[model samples]
Target: MTPLTVEVTSSTGSDHLLPSKDPWYTAPADFEASIPGTVLRIRTVPGQPTVFSNAAAAYHILYRTTGSRYQPTWAVTSLVIPKKPCVHSGYNALLSYQMAYNTPTIDRGPSYRIFEPPLPNNYGIPPGHQQFDIMLDRGWFVTIPDFEGPRAAFGASVQAGHATLDGIRAVLSLAGHPDIPLPSSADKFKYAMWGYSGGSIASEKAAELQVQYAPELARGFVGAALGGLVSNVGSLYTVTNKTPYMGNLVLILLGVMNEYPEVDTYLRSRLKTEGPQNATAFLKGRDMDSFQAFQTYAGQDIFEYFVGGEADLEACQALRKIKMVEWMLGYHGAPEVPLFVYKAIEDELTPIADTDAHMEHYKRFNVSVLYERNTVGGHISEIVNGQDRAIKWLASVFDSSYDKEGGIKTRDVTVDIYKPPIP
Candidate 1:
C-alpha cells in the first residue's frame, strides 16, 4: 500500500497565522502536525475572544503524497474541540463540520479555524461564551472540517462530503494528541454532524456517503442536523436562472457543472458560445465578494449573446441531463440514527418546496428527518442565526443525554418573486 503523507502546512510556509485576538474565549495552545502517507494542515483560523455567543475552532486538511510532481494541496479542516469523547465504532473521536457552498469563503475555500464556545441565547450560559472551553468542560471534543478538499475542490458536493468524512477518520485515527483522550482501540467511538445553507449541502451529502464509502465509519455517525440545505440544483436553476439571484446561482451551477461533465456541456450549450471558457474562470474568481452584482456583468442580459435566441427547451433539457435532484432523492439519510433538518421559512436562496419535497423523499427511506421552517430570518440570517441551533443539536449527538435543551424551530414558508426574465 502506498504510504500516506501529512504535515503541518499552516505553521510553516507562506501561511499567515492570525493573532488570537478573539473577544469571547482564549484558544488552547495552538500547534500544527503532519504525518506521512495521510494529510496536512495548511492554514489555521484562530479562535475568537468573545464576539458571538458560541464559536468553534476550524482547520483545513490537505492530502499529501510522496514523489508526486504536484505537491499535496489544501483540502478541508474543521473547528476542533480537544478532549471530547471518541464515538465511532472503530474510531474514538468527534469532529463537527461546517458545510461547503459556492460563495467560496467558508464554502469551498480553505478551512477557517473555529473556537467552540457557548450558544448565544439558546443555552443562556451567559453572553460571553467560549465553545472550546465549554466542550472541554463537558467531556466532549469538537472539530470543524474545512470541507473544501485539496485546492478548495470547489462545487463538487460529493467530493466535499467524502473529504469531511475522511477528515474525521483521519483525526480520530491520530495516534496521540493533547486535546483528545485516548480510548483503548477496542472501544467503539461515536460522531455527529451539523450544517446550514451551503454547509448543510456538504453535511447532507457526507451523511449519505458515510455508509457506502466508509463502512468502517458506519457505526460511529450517530446523528446529523442540516438547515437551509441546497438539495436540488435543477429546481434552483429553474426558479433563479436569469434573475438577479442567478448570479449566486451561477457559481454553484458552474461548480457542479464542472464536477459532472454532462452538466458542463449542457451549460456550455446554453451559456457558452464556443465554449463558455470564461465560466470556469469567473466561478473561482468571484467569492461572495459581490454576489449581488454579478448579474450586471455575466447574467442573461449579457449572456443572451450565447443563448442562440433559444432559452427554454435547450436550457431546461440540458439541465435535466445533470439529474442533481433525482440524485438527491436517492441519497441515504442520516445513519439510522436520530436526525435533525431545518429550512428557513423565507429562504431566498433555496426553494422551500424543494426542501419539502426532499424531506418527503427522506421519509421513504425511513430516515429520521426533522425539517424546520424559520419564520424570521432570510437566507443569510439562516447562516448566522442557524449556528446556535446547529451547535446545540451537534452537542446532543456527541452526548445523547445532552438533548434536553430547546432548539429553535421554523414553519412559515414564502418565495420571493423574480424580476422580469433577463433574456
Candidate 2:
C-alpha cells in the first residue's frame, strides 16, 4: 500500500504519513488492559523536543476510551512524573490540564504542543504554559490528554469528557508498574482539573459527566476551575453566522461532520462546489488557526450557501439539538464536584448572560460553586485575568484535609463581580 500525503503547512515528521481525507490515527494494539479506560500501549522512550526531560521522567500513553455514543475509541496522553518530591504532604499531586486548541486536528494536541520549539508553533502551546510550569516546578505530576479524541471532535463534549477522565484513569492505572515509578499509593494524590477558554469546555464537561459516567474516576477529583465557559452553542452559531467570524460555523460543522454521520450527509447534500470546498479546507487544514478558519469561510453563512431554501434543509433540524439543549451544559444537570467558574461579562465569544443561566441551573443542584464574573475583560483579556485566581483556588483545594467536599453542596454558590487588574 502506498503512503498517502496530506497538504498544509506540515512537516515530514510524525511516524505516519497520513492521507488528505480523514487521516486514520491507529497503532498495532493488543488491548491488554481491556477496561473502559485502559492503556493499550505505553511509550517510555521520550520524543524529540522534550519539555521537562531534566526534572521529569516523561512518557506517552495510547489508551482506550469511549466516544460520544459509548463506542470503543482511542486517545493519546502525555504523562509527566516529577523526579523531586512534593511540596506539602510529600505526596505528588496530579493535575489534568486541558488546553483549548479549538481546532479539530488530532496532530496538534498537547502531546505534540509541549514538546520542542517548532512543533508548538502549529500544535499550540497552552496559553497557561507559565502556570503549567509552575505546577511542574512544584514537582506535580500532570497528564495532558488529547481530549479532542483521535478524529478531533473539537466541540463534542461527551467525547472530550470521556477522553479527559480516561486519560487520568490510564495514568493512575499505571501505578505498581515496574518501569513507571509512580507513588505506591497513587490514589493518595489529590486530583484537580483546570482549563481556560476553549479548554474550559472540556474541563466543565468532564466535571458534569464525572458522577454519572465515571463514578470511580470522579472520586479522586477535588475541584475543577473553568473560565470562559461555553454555556450555549446555539448562541455561538447564531452570533457567528453570516458575520466576519463565520469561520466558526465551518469549524463546528467540520467537527460535527466527523462525529455525526447524519451531520455530514445532511450538510454535504446541501452544498454545491463551494460547500465541499470549505469542508475539505477544514479537513485538510485541521490545524487551522481560528482566524484562518474564519477567513476561509469569512462573510458567508451556511444558509446563504444552501442550494435550496433554508426551510428545505432537514439536516438543520437534526443539528438543532446540538446548538440548544442537548450538548450545552446546565441543561443536563449539575456536576457533583466543587466548581470554580469565572467568566468575563464583556465576553464576545460566549455571552455572560448564558453563563449566568448556566450558573443558576447548577445552583439548583446545590453544588458548591465559586462564581466570579469579571467586569473588566473580553474573551482574550479574561484568560490572563481569571487564570491567576483559579490557580490560587486550586492551591487551597489541595492544601488541607478539604479534598472531599460531599453532596450537591447546600450552601449558596458564591458569586463575585470584580474588576481584574489590567496586565
Using TM-score, give the best candidate's number. 2
* Candidate 1 colliding pairs, count: 59
Per residue, candidate 2 scores C-alpha lDDT tens digits across 1-423 of 100111112223444322123233464455424666777666642343244543466667777888876777888887777667475665457889898776766655677656644323221223445666677776778888888787788777788888898888877777666666677665767787888866788888888878887888765678888888888766776666776666665666667677778877887777654745443554544566465676677777656555664553434876777655435876545787788888778777788888887777776667878778876757766677776778778877777544445333322222333344434
Return the TM-score for candidate 1, rounded to 2 decimals: 0.65
- The parts of candidate 2 lying over 4 Å away from their true place are 1-33, 45-49, 52-55, 118-126, 242-244, 274-287, 298-302, 308-317, 324-326, 401-423
For each candidate in turn, the TM-score is: 0.65, 0.82
Q: Per-model C-alpha lDDT, please? A: 0.50, 0.68
lDDT of 1 by residue, 1-423 (tens): 111223332333333342222221111121122332144333344433233323333334343221111223234444444433434224543646554334533332423323333223221112213434454444455555556543343455666666667666765554353332334341345777766666676677778877766677666677777767777755655665565566555455555554456665665655543454344444454344223335333445334434553353245654454345322534544445556776677776678778777766766566665556776656655654555665676666666654422332235543232222233
* Alpha-carbon deviation at 78 in model 1, angstroms: 4.1
In candidate 2, how many clashes are counted?
A: 0
Alpha carbon lDDT at 362, candidate 1: 63
